[model samples]
Target: MRRASSLIAYAIACCLGWPAQAQDYPAHPIRIIVPTQAGGVSDILSRTFANKVQNATGATVVVENRTGANGVLAADYVAKSTPDGYTVYLGFQGTQSVLPHVEPKLPYDPTRDFAPVVLLATGPAVLVVHPSMPARSVKELVELAKAKPGAYSYASAGFGTTHHLAAEMFKLAAGVDLTGVTYRGAAPANQDVIAGHVPIEFDNLGLAVNNIRSGAVRPLAITAKDRSPLLPDVPTMAEAGYPSVIAQSWFAFFVPAKTPRPAIDWLNRQANEVFSDPAMRDQFLRQGLVLPLGSPEFLGQHVAEETQRWGEVIRKAKITLPN
Candidate 1:
């Protein structure tokens, strides 16, 4: 009878302790995993957010770069981790939405394997061309490409990358046959475009801004519905008559699917607090990331919608990666 009473007491204690465990989240160091290399936009964003979280809560937060298989490796690591919220994923649109449609046999299901925390930000791509190219505007570039089908080749980060998909969208929308020259990543692709080896390319606004400002590449159009304040002069793809070619890269935070709701709530509250600061908001704006801060539900809904959108694009473009 005494042993039974003790067992009942222990069960009650465990039930009561659940809330405490959730409240004491980050009792240890939290690690934010970036799927790309250090110094890229993902790396910088993760580090900045980590620093903010650390400063705000006195938590020992750290950012780690687990680069491989175009973010699949890092994502898989986070998906399989213990659902304690210590291991966080800094996921972006490409890996979370686009990859599912492209990779035939993904190790982890993006929509199923993770729980959404928050939608961080979104940045659009810019259509750029070599300075010496006669095509100045989006129309002129389309005219040139249409005039000589398959004659012009654009540089892309890789086969299934955002820029590559943008180029494919452009091809479908403009009825042009511009060849795609694939590079390992955006830096080398942008380098080739700047060197005039490739005449045209679509690149991220943040990474393409400095080169555009320096006149290394001429800006033609932005793949957004509205113009960015940083490049007010640049017209939108819709304005340029290609309303169908809008593509924006987004970033968000996610934890493993079974992570406790309290931990997710705490992380969401922290991110919303840190990023909603006006100074921080303006800082991201200047860097070309438009914050879309909201509840975890918002992130989940947005990811679902984006997954559908990108899946359609991938199907139309027939994009696939090797298993």
Candidate 2:
């Protein structure tokens, strides 16, 4: 009886300690899933995090781009993955906000299907214009658009993308109608704007920063509440007298659903640590990423807010996409 009781105690201890043992967390190479193709902002940020995490923890971090369906494919993949913290997702505003509004049959719920890790960045869009637009300020641009409603056209990366919705909001707030031309990705949209084929676009800061600096495009306003440090003289839409017009993109990390809180917390702490490092902060800023971050709770709140906010925009704009 004594021997049997001792054996039972040993078994119980192992069972209880199973998760703790696995708390070495990423025992093998981990995957950082970027829902878009390589070279996009989300992909770039995910790679940065992957490299930093690999250096900090000695765990091999691989960035896997699973692009399609405006991120539904990759998001669904991550949603159904094991809750063992081995698979991490890099999510952006499109997946969290626009996709849900545009497509009602999403396979996974953004808030419920994943464990929110930490916000990666809140990169604002810049109001980029062709070189010959003759609008150097937000007021001037509004005047120009007002003078010729629907004459000035803008190109966006896609239908229902944050860039498109932001442009829609800007049109409503500025009381001007700019024809929207959709493209497959930022590269083509930005290309048309730079070549003066389209007169205006509100492009993601990271995507347009180099071109804006190189005179490929001109920036009039940044779509944040405050002007971007990179564009010091540019006014925010709200600051430029358009309070209801704000378009910003937020990127976040997530683990599969039901992941242990400890694992999620640890990843969040690691991300916060990375964000607080001045070197990382400066490097990200140079990459056109702004740190607007906090705990997983903050990401949860952000998801809720943006989901509702973009929903309203889509409804009012009566926006629909083409196949």
Candidate 3:
């Protein structure tokens, strides 16, 4: 009898245009899971947004690092967590788009397991070479790699990452035979390039910006349609005669599928409010990220498009990772 009474009360509340949970949403602290290690661009960006959201909503937002399996672990954890608004995942290009193509047995489906929240930011990968290397431009690098024919090598975050795929695309377009050296993450891969251990690498602009400015590594070209404002003098891959070699990494937010509509709407509004701030815009821009805020539907469409695009690249390149 009591359970029936409670259901009747909830129905009455809904009929009156009031939902109790939505009205008092986010009543407790929220937790965000970052799938990568601390100090990388993704980690920094996730923490920055988390801080902004906490300040805006006056709710505790805790960021937890659950790094492993190229972000599969964290993504799976969030996908299986409660559908309440409290648990969120920072979804990136690898987990959302790339892995589905390269890894045949992903534990969670990108499209089916999560609800899109918002598209946060996007940035092109920068092709940088050690100062000790002879190449000064993208064309020169291609020529050098052709001349050596597998003598020169490039580094990547790991197999199936954007960094790896970007290098593969460059190889196919430029018709070069450069070997790829894999690392656990971008930081270590970039570190080898900066230390002159690796001759070349394709890294996110945000991670390579400081080193580029310091002359620790020389940037050949950015993998975007246009040159980034942060590196205005650098030409794009298209300008370097490889028009098909364009690639960029993007970040978004997601919650488990079947989450309440009102909770999702509230989270979207909060994200838009935080990203629309002038200060936040400038901060992201300085780090070589372009903030392109859009609706959840827009993010869903972007994810689908990117998955198809990268899947083709992976198939053509014959890219695969170990199980």
Candidate 4:
């Protein structure tokens, strides 16, 4: 009886030690690696998360930008970091899925090297046209582009980025040809769009929403089956008669692979809490995000499904890019 009692006590202690030990998680400052440039969506959103994390965990959270190679540089660094939960990467859909599809030689496999913490938010891609363009709706834009293939130039935040892939997918689905012009980031590219230097752009709602409200740019369609709350009147890609062209981009959280499960759980819970917070939700809205929260397992499956979906698009299109 004494031996059995000891064994039971040891089992209970082992289970209790997990999260109790995790209390030491951010013993020092935590570093969040943002895979894009300093001003992009991931950068802004991650910084907001980091600030709230600092308040919740009582540890300073720093955002480090490691740009280039379409976010592979940041992925490689974080994947190689210690699994002590001090380092994490903000994984964007394009950087994780579409870039690998287009470039074909990403340094680290997203599924292999990282563990998802939580799904932060999803930003549906929006098709916006310059005021100078005659198109007022998705069908009209398609008709015009079909009428003059390659005559209308559309700006992309980056080459083979989610926006670019979405545009390609739409073109494939709509059977239209519009030339793509790649830019360093959405802000500048969006600026050009608003200025009418580019005839059209496939942008995330964050960049295009306010401009759209101000009538600086014309919204053609949302890349989703249903209209977005931010743009309720704008028709969905499906409603525009191209249901298959719909695609919504998202951002996810990840720590280096092999981070303890308890730590991952804690982080995910903290993230869900943040997402549920009214202040944080409002903050995300101000930044043009519609915050959607989910568990680590949910985020993992989402990344897996998104990766597979992008793979299907690439395989069907047989997409290739130059170095």
Please name the candidate that would achieve the greatest lDDT relative to the true structure.
Answer: 1
RMSD of model 4 against the true structure: 4.0
lDDT of 1: 0.89
TM-score (C-alpha) between model 1 and the true structure: 0.92
Worst 10 residues of 4 by lDDT: 283-292
TM-score of each: 0.92, 0.89, 0.89, 0.87
lDDT (Cα) of model 4: 0.82
Task: Name model 2 segments beyond 4 Å from true.
Answer: 1-22
Report every candidate's CA lDDT: 0.89, 0.84, 0.88, 0.82
* TM-score-best of 1 and 2: 1
Best by TM-score: 1
* Full-model lDDT, candidate 3: 0.88
Query: Is 3 or 4 the stronger prediction by lDDT?
Result: 3
**Backbone collision tally, model 1:** 0
Assess candidate 2 and give its lDDT. 0.84
Q: Which is the winner by TM-score between candidate 1 and candidate 3?
A: 1
Write one digit per residue (lDDT tens) for candidate 2, span 219-289. 88788877777878777887778877878888899989898776788678777876788887888888678
In candidate 2, list every pair of residues with a backbone clash: none
Compute the lDDT of residue 144 as modeled in candidate 1: 89
